[model samples]
Target chain A: MSDDGFLRVADVSKWYGDEQVLHDVSFEMDRGDVTVLIGPSGSGKSTMLRCVNRLAEAQEGSILLDGEEVLSPDLDVNDLRREVGMVFQGFNLFAHLTAVGNVALGPRRVLGLSEAAARERAEAQLERVGLGDQFDSYPAELSGGQQQRVGIARALAMEPKLLLFDEPTSALDPELIGEVLEVMHGLVDEGMTMLVVTHEMSFAREVADEIVFLDDGRVVERGPPDQLFERPERERTGRFLERIASHD
Target chain B: MAGATRPATVRERVADSDRSVGRLLLVAAGALFWGWLVVSWVNRWLGGVLVPVGDPLVPPGAVEATLAAIPGIAAYAADAAFVVELSPEIARGTWLTVVITAASLVVGFFIAVPLAVTRVYGRFSAWVSLAYTELLRGTPLLAQLFVLHYGLNLGSYVPDTLSGVFARNVVWVAIVGFTLNGAAYQAEYIRGAIESVEEGQITAGRAIGLSKLETIYYVVLPQGLRYAIPSWTNEFVYLIKYSSLAAFITVPELYYRADQIASETFRYTLIFIVTGVTYLALVLTASKLMERVESRVSIPGLGVDRER
Candidate 1:
């Protein structure tokens, strides 16, 4: 509930018809900090990420992004989306555009950058993700790993203050997962502020500033990865960790 | 077991022979039709030698003597002579048909895009688009043309200067009718195409900060239109053939011209055959052209069979 945090979500509740999806979920991240939300399926992890960008509206909540009330009805959703970029689990690159075209679209159209300038910016982002040679390749022509990198590049092209990753590696193959994670690791090294919902416990343990364990649409526990993984305070958190560890 | 199989095998053979005979007849009929078309097409150009006004390709009498020496071909050449006489008129009519079809299709495209967007994304106005598509699609185009030309007297509303160069108002009325009809069908094609695009694309578009309309325009329509090319090509062919309906209102397109020539010369069989062949040629050529366009605009790895 502190207004001093870089990005804050407090008392956020959402409903799809009569069923409640998120129940008073609250979290905060400092600038350049990585917060990972991990939970079982149907635990409102993805919905919580979506609410930050207003992709899914929260019926009851106050989401403040850099002290600006994002939940305000008068706020322009497009403007909010520009500052808060999201990388989907499904690398939803435009099918008709090339890898560079996919990255350039936001800059060219939304940011009003010239075609040459946008393309130059897109190439720079793509190169950052190790896709400099694939500027002309379409999404269908790229591997799942490469496409996810392009997706990351697309989000980075907008130069957003906060980035949301909704299970970004979930849709990738086991071998391809490393490449996307590597790009994310690079982003982390450069100090990008990120809120990620993921099942990659290793990733969370390594890179996360804080790991928030969510269960049944609420924050069950929040601490550093070592503290949460090694010395858990909550019984549900220990059970969830054991269950996920069993899968791996 | 052999005795029982014998009768069944005989019956099967009889059926197979029957099918073969039918196929043979079909092939013969096809050959005759193509032969007649080739003869008429050749005579339409070559029959000019019958005239003695200019320096003949060969001496006029010499060409005639050679044609006569060919026996059955001479008879075909004689029979096909009218095709030469009618060629200029048919050519003009074909040009008009092409113009009308192309204009209507282009104009209909502009109208259909908005109409399709409304049907897919318009919260309250979706039903309005649905009603328009159903009304146009449910009714016969001929009926619509009649209502426009006769009931509404749309032709009279057009000034003489515009219609004078064309066939006095009926042509414009036909264009209007065909455009309205085409837009409805085209919109449906586009609507289906738009829907076929994955929902994630719109979410992705919005996530990248595009407005709903921008997403539809940039993310949705490009892929949708690519998906629509096959169906849109179908609509194009349909428009070409349905344009014949304009002749009902006396728009002097190919069919109308042929009908006029048929009644005037009392050569219904011959004139109608020529007209039918002309339409066949037009449709086939149009299909080939559209196929080229489809390939030209098609994105690699995005066609139906290419889906991952």
Candidate 2:
């Protein structure tokens, strides 16, 4: 019931059939905060972030976006999704649409912006993500990194209160990962509220205000990125960090 | 990763041109061989059919005179002139066939989309669409036309003005039957395309704040419809040919006109050949038009276009 934070996920749990993917999880993010969720595969990091926009519904929990009950039965889900934008791991840009078209769709359809206004906003977002020249390019024409940036632009075009990224750079070619991360880094610099799920420890270290380390569907540790990444207090957290470091 | 290279040397370019020329010559030769085969077959068939039957009892001139006395020569001349004596009745009937096919498709498309969406993704109402689609598709179009035109007999049940309209216009019965029949097949094509859309696209749509209906409308249907174009084009051409079925109902479509002309002049070959060519033109034009539309809507790296 508290409204101390801009977004809150309290006592959240989720299941896919018989398997509980997320345990009781709680985290809070203030306005303009960047929270990075890092964990092993299937650690429920993506599932937790998905709960905020009701993309993956939480079985037991409260998610408040801009202090409104996101988990409420009568909540306008589309409105929640408008407030909470998401960048997919697969960069699921509409293949039929050009980059600008994909970015403008939510603005025109959901926000009911006039076509000119939506186009203007989409152009701005696409330019912001360093894709000024790709306005007319289809997703297939663009590189994986460029497509992900368009994905980010699509999310940003909504001017959402919060942005969720699910392993945004994981699907990119190794050489192209920096371009997408650079855009996210720019967002953090501009004080955007972002909940990121990624294995990019360097991005988390540099941009995240705090890092929540999850393992086995549970939050094992939460602290400032410097303390959590470098000086992890829990043994499991330390071991997980060591494993990822070696894997990289 | 390689550095830009200079243009090819003169000898290399000449060699490349020579190679392409050789390939083109080979292709031309193959095409000519196939054309020769087709020409020879046509020549054989024509020779057999056009030869006057030799009766030892009668002279060739007498036979020719006898044939000329009949209407067959005039009819054959009419066919050759590209000005066959088609009655106004046949003309109007053919136009009516066009109207029925086009109207049925337009109306059928509207019916099919919703029917397909409900059948593929709906809860309880899906079964209702399933039943309707299956039942219509299971029965023959002729039987359905007969049921509407003769069995139900809308003429007797309707008001006097509409009753006269329904009874007098046999094309209306054919239209209703074709629309119902086409809708079922169209729904299957549309539904298959809709299902072919990746699940990820739907998630992406929803993630960007589109409602379920909006997602289907904006994302799913556009892609699905593009994917369905080839099948849909097939259906359109089928409708054009199938409109001939209206002839049984006395709608006087091209086939019916040909039948009437054949019956009147007793030159079945001439009338039928012209009629066959007309239908061929219709099918070819429809295919070309739809192919243009399909290419225009095709996603660059998705569906059938991905092959390129």
- Scored by TM-score, the top model is 1
TM-scores for chain A, candidates in order?
0.98, 0.97
Each model: TM-score of chain B? 0.77, 0.70
Clashing pairs in 2: none
Best by DockQ: 2
Q: What is model 2's DockQ versus the real complex? A: 0.71
Question: Which candidate number has the best lDDT?
Answer: 1
Q: Write down the lDDT of every candidate, Cα atoms only.
A: 0.88, 0.83
Q: Cα miss at A184, model 1 (Å)?
A: 0.5
**Which tens-of-lDDT digit does each residue in B20-127 have in candidate 2?**
999688557655533533343343335523222211222434554555567848444434433223423334444566678898998999999999999888988899
Candidate 2 regions exceeding 4 Å error are A1-3, B1-83, B87-91, B155-168, B304-308
TM-scores, all candidates, are 0.88, 0.83
**Local error of candidate 2 at residue B55 (angstroms):** 36
CAPRI quality level assigned to candidate 1 from its DockQ score: medium
On the 0 to 100 scale, the lDDT of residue B139 in model 2 is 91
